[model samples]
Target: MNYLNKLERKIGKYAIPNLSLWLVVTYALGYLMMYMTPGIISYLMLEPAMVLRGQVWRLVTWVLIPPSTGNIFFYIIMIMLYYSLGTALERTWGTFRFNVYIFGGMIFTVIGAFVAYGFLSVTGGLTIGIGYYVTTYYINMAIFLAFAVCFPNMQILLWFIIPVRMKWMAYVYAALTIYDFVTTGAVGRISIAAALLNFLIFYLSTRNYQRVSPKEVHRKYVFKTQMRDAEMRHSGGVTKHKCAVCGRTEKDDPTLEFRFCSKCDGNYEYCQDHLFTHEHIKRS
Candidate 1:
């Protein structure tokens, strides 16, 4: 986690904001291609053999392949759900960490494809179209699983009617995934493991487990509600923004603009004059 923090500090500015929206747009484009020019879809798959043969575009273009195509209604619903989940994760984890998690899964999936290809070649097995087995399906599953871990008790309407908690859904997902891995071929198993490896490595290894405990979650929820009520009660008296450095608020200078510092360790804000000059706050 410390290493990740350092890396984020160095290159976090390059991380994409609203990456989920772009991903959804990419899927939409892929869907359009599927309907308009179906043959082009094959050229976009992450086929190792094709890539090695100098069709290197296949390596990156594969991400544009939509996970599934059937009922348009369900597909739209799935895209919206994933977009919400991805946005929540990006907000909670910050852009850089979310980007690492997503890109890490993609890199692993690419490696897994090549690994599977090598194994097949060595074993005198079929090697054509190996990329067909690998898709963003498991990557989407990883996003959902990560969200479940962070907000286990969050409830949503199941099939737009029955209410269900995310943890229960996660359990069902895990069970189904395990069943599929056990029943499917080597390629399928590798694809699943590769895509989900990022979740296991990032969340399980670095997350503060205590923060996810039922008691902790409940306590935080109560505290947040209390703070919200207090803020509401004092809303008329309190200023909306304040500068941590200058100790100034909009009440002090109506023309002053305040902004939160992304480089700071905590939620520190600054007024326009000191925004660039103030030293960032860091916890030891």
Candidate 2:
């Protein structure tokens, strides 16, 4: 993580903000193109053989191939989900880190495709079916899994009725991915490994396993809820001027001035002391 931090300091200036938004837009456009001309996707597949044969655009153009296509409702939901998760990760990790994580995954995926190509080419001449295994499906799944790790306690209304925690769903996703890997052929396994290698490296290096435990999440939830309830009760259910950093209200410190930070992404109030010293939060 320290090494990554140093790297970020060196190249963070080149980071593209709202990168996920552009990615989502690209997916949408790709889907539109698919609908308009189904044959167009063949030209965009990640085919190293084709690239070696002079179709070099396939290397980058494959990103335009949407992961899946079926029901309109589900497609919209999938796009929105990735957009939300990607944006949240961008906000949490800062633009440079998020960019590195995403682009690193892409680079690993490309390496996986080339590795599979080499293995296949050595055994038999280049096969026509290899690129079918390489797609954006696993890459998007990695993004979703990373978000679940970072915000495990966050809940989603499954089917707009049943409340489900992100961690539980992530576990289910992991199980399904594992099952696919175990049951699939070597090509599929290699593809999956290549796709997920970035996530494995990213999480293993930076994850604070202790903080993600159920007990820690529950304790923080309870403490914050109780503090909020106490503040509400103290203010007769009309609270205002609360400090974002310490959760201190004007009632707690009558003399402490409160000010809203202009640099923070959202509306964040800070106490007089922290007003100048608190870390600025920016959402991209």
Candidate 3:
């Protein structure tokens, strides 16, 4: 993270702002184009074979491929969900880090496609041939997975009723992605691996694997809640006098006496136990 901070200081000025919103708009345009002219996606797919044959446009155009072929309602919902996730990530990680995550995934996906083509060419088997499998589908899914890892405690309303934590959803997503990889041919496995490689790298970079565990998250949550509750009680004036040493107040021990020290430089107050034994406060 310190290294990232130094890198950000050097090149953060060049990062694109609101990059996620632009990506969502591009996806919307892609969906619209698909709706208007069916079968147009055949030309936009990430086909390394075609790229090698001089169709270089396929490299960048493949991002226009919509992740889902559902109806308009479903498209709208998917767009909304991804837009929220992407924007939240941008806000949390800043534009530079978010740019690295998304574009790194795309670059890895392209590399994976070429690797698939090379493997198929050598084997002469050509299983699936890396046609449409290397699309932005898994890349988009990786964005959601990254979000879940970042905000594990965040809750989402499932079907507008059941509340689910982001961490649980992340687990489910990982399971489904793994299942898809195993059931499909080697091409699918390579594509999934490439698409999710960015997420894996980013997750490891955080060094927060243990922090996301259920027990650790719960313990942190409890500690934060206790501190907040104590602050609220103090702010509400429930405890008028407090011992500086033990951080307790009249509310905790009404029988204890508190007094300001005359010899101390400032208005240092202490309870009976610490009033005589504590060192006197002094201005440096």
Backbone clash pairs in model 1 (N, Cα, C under 3 Å; residues 3+ apart or in different chains), count? 0
- Residue 136, model 1: lDDT of 89
Of 1 and 3, which scores higher on TM-score?
Answer: 1
TM-score of 3: 0.71
C-alpha lDDT of residue 211 in model 1:
86
Q: What is the total number of backbone clashes in candidate 2?
A: 0
Per-candidate Cα lDDT values, in order, are 0.91, 0.89, 0.88
lDDT of 1 by residue, 1-284 (tens): 89899999899999999889988999999988888998998999998988899999988998988888889899999999999999999999999999999999999999999998888889888888787888988999999999999999999899999999999999999999999899989888888889889988977786678988999999999999999998889887688899998799999889999999999999898999989999988899
Please give, for residues 1-284, the per-residue lDDT of candidate 3 as tens digits: 78778988999899888888888888888888888997888888888888888999999988887788788888888888998999999999999999888999999999999888888889896634487788788988999999998899999998779999999999999999989999998888999999999999988887857878999999999999999999997789656688889988888878989999898998878999999999888888
Candidate 2 deviant stretches above 4 angstroms: 207-284
* lDDT winner between candidates 1 and 3: 1
Error of 1 at 107 (Å): 0.7
How much lDDT does candidate 2 score?
Answer: 0.89
| Candidate 2, residue 190: how far the Cα is off, in Å | 0.9
Backbone clash numbers for all candidates listed: 0, 0, 0
